[model samples]
Target: MQSRTGARWEEFLGRLDRRLVSLGLVLFTLPPLVGKWVLPLTASSPSRALQAAVEAIPPEKLVFISSDWDAGTQAESRPQLTAIVRHLLKQKRKFVLFSVNSPTGPQIAQTTVEKAIKEEDLTEEQWKYGRDWANLGYKVANTPWIRTLSRSIQEAMKEDWQNTPISELEILKGVDRWGPDGQVAMLIDVTGSATIEYWYAYLTPTKVKLGLACTGVMAPEQYPYLDSGQLSGMLTGMKGAAEYFELIGAPSPELRVTMAGQSFAHLYIVLLILLGNVPIFLGWWQRRQR
Candidate 1:
């Protein structure tokens, strides 16, 4: 009778062991998949920060945007750029956009703006180009040009993206040429490179408020700027994009849904790890009893 009881106990332990392992595997693999359903995971905070920055932009003022990203960073940069432009458009702020890195920077910037416009259901007249905003397009290379432009906007950008002179743009009419007091209301830098450092050197001293949005991996490098208040705010990665979406009260279905899956996946793996550990503990305790 005692021997039969021992055999039954061993069989129960074996079943439990198998069940725990199976549960562990499922937990490890399932969260990321289910995380898709978890809307608004880690992006909420950064999105609010960006929204606050946008709200702070004075009415009818022109903001300066340095767009230094290309197709390679579209996964991160695109959504950030979209959110920023959406805020600017909603607030009716005028802006001047320029790019330093890729030749396609201007095109990408235009696409970002257009995408926002479409998503927001805004008409062209409501946020007209050349009037509401202007694209200086891809001008010169980095740092040196940024410094030179900080000193003299006219000299820095002789013509607009379409080859139209800045002097000829209706939106730029009567705007003080980029001189010392002729500072922009704000400066937004969205880039995939460390070119942000150059803006800090050349433009920050001018007292133009600055905001930044970069790829996920670039966020760590930007913490110093945020701590020093050199950057008024920032957005990092797809999570940041989702947060910005929420802040605008225009969350994209695809982004929110995808983030949910990621969040769930993380939780699932954590639970599975704990579950798997329980069996090992029990097994070890049983062996020590012998």
Candidate 2:
């Protein structure tokens, strides 16, 4: 009779396990997908450091941004770029954008800037393209390209995205040459791949301050650069982007919702694991009573 009872409990638990799994999935899925919950925001130190570094650059200073991420990393890299661009635009700080690794990188960065300006309702006179900003578009993205660019900006990039002479662009006013002493106040790389390595290996010795925003996977391995002082600050993955959103004082509901989904998924998995072990616990309890 006891053996039969155990079998019954096992069967019931099997069914219960299946039901719990389904229930947990539903609970975790719906709220975030619908953006139904509000969660507290906490900005990590690295993210805050990133914002501080960018903010330290004076409005008169021009920043050089390397948009090394393609569409594959849009969810994370886009927000980082958008938030950074929005901040730069707001501060009236001019910046030049270029892409090294990906062909679509330049266009993606441009789109993000446009979206940011639109979202902020910025006026043409305030953040005018070609005057306040210039997109140098794509170029050879390797050690040799880096050497060429660092050696001479004019030789490396002669034209803008529209094929107009970069010499005529108003945004190139301060940047007659390359390196930290010229128009570039800093260099920021928002990348999804190994492109930051090139920046570190090539650009570190230059006077230009460097910063990074990369996917979570690449972030761990890249910490050594930070330790080596090659990277002034860094942002990692979607979490990093969300933290940046916090820093910019523009918290994104979509990001919060996604974070909620992630949190709930983890909790649900833990609950399922505990519940799955319940049958064994119950069996042990039964033996103790016997």
Candidate 3:
């Protein structure tokens, strides 16, 4: 009788409604995403290192931002780019922006930068283009261009994204190269593609500090670089952005809500997996006794 009852219970458990499971997930996940609650998170070591690296850049040197991501990865990359940009602007760090992997990258980065500037409440006088920053836009030469960029900034390109002569930009006044002795303080590549390879192949051994902001899928591949000291630090996807926000003493509400939703959803899924296996385990135990 005990065995028969166990078999019947197992059959009933196997027939549990999929719709109910889906509904339960919705119940567990939706509230957090829609709510204003932001769970506190500790900043990871990589995040701290990235922030420290940026801070370590000398005041007079320019930070090179190679934004190589487009809308396809915006949900993750946008926040990463924005957080770094906000940090740079807030610290009054002069920088330059450009894209080589994606034609749309520069435009998207520009939008993110503008958003950051507005959020930081910076004035035109405080953060003017051609002085505080410059947009070199997108270039297509890839390896060759980067090789040229390594040797001479003046020879690599002559115009900004707006077609304005690079010579007219006060930001590039004395900037002529990128190396240990160059005017570039550090090169930060914010990308979702494999473009970092170009930097590694052509630019890594130059003694310039390098950083990366990449998607979650790309994060694992970059760990070796971090471990080997080829990279100064990294910000991986949305979670990385959130960690950065924490390090900067500014938590993003949107990230807080999104993270809470993901956390709850993950927990719910794990619980369901454990519960789903219980009936099978009990059935096996009953059969063993028989």
Reference-based TM-score of each model: 0.75, 0.81, 0.85
Q: What Cα-based lDDT does every candidate model obtain?
A: 0.75, 0.80, 0.86
- Candidate 3 regions exceeding 4 Å error are 1-28, 268-290
Expressed as tens digits, the lDDT of each residue in 1-290 for candidate 1 is 23444556556656776677667656764655555455435454545666787688767567888898999988778887887888787787888888887789899899788878888798888778888888888966766777777776766777888899888888777665342366466878888877688778887777777788888889988888887878888888767877887777776777766556555556766875665455555666667777
Cα lDDT of model 1 overall? 0.75
Better-scoring candidate (TM-score), 1 or 3: 3
lDDT of 2 by residue, 1-290 (tens): 34555677667766675666678688777877686675787887778877888898867778888999898998888888887787777666788999888888999888888888888788766678889888999887767778878766777888988798988898785365545566676889988888877777766666677889888888889778777777878888888888888888888888877767766877888976776666676678878888
Clashes of each: 12, 0, 0
For each candidate in turn, give its C-alpha RMSD to the true structure in angstroms.
Answer: 7.4, 4.6, 3.6
- Quote the lDDT for 161 in model 2: 80
Given candidate 1, what's the lDDT at residue 155?
A: 68
Model 2 regions more than 4 Å off? 1-27, 174-180, 266-290
lDDT of each residue in 1-290, candidate 3, tens digit only? 34566567668777989899999999999988877567778777777879999999988888999999999999889999999998998788998998888999888999899889888999767799899998899988467778988778888868999899999999988788776698887889999898888888877767788899998889889889999888899998888899998788777988978878877988999998877666677778877888
User: Using alpha carbons, what is the TM-score of model 2?
Assistant: 0.81
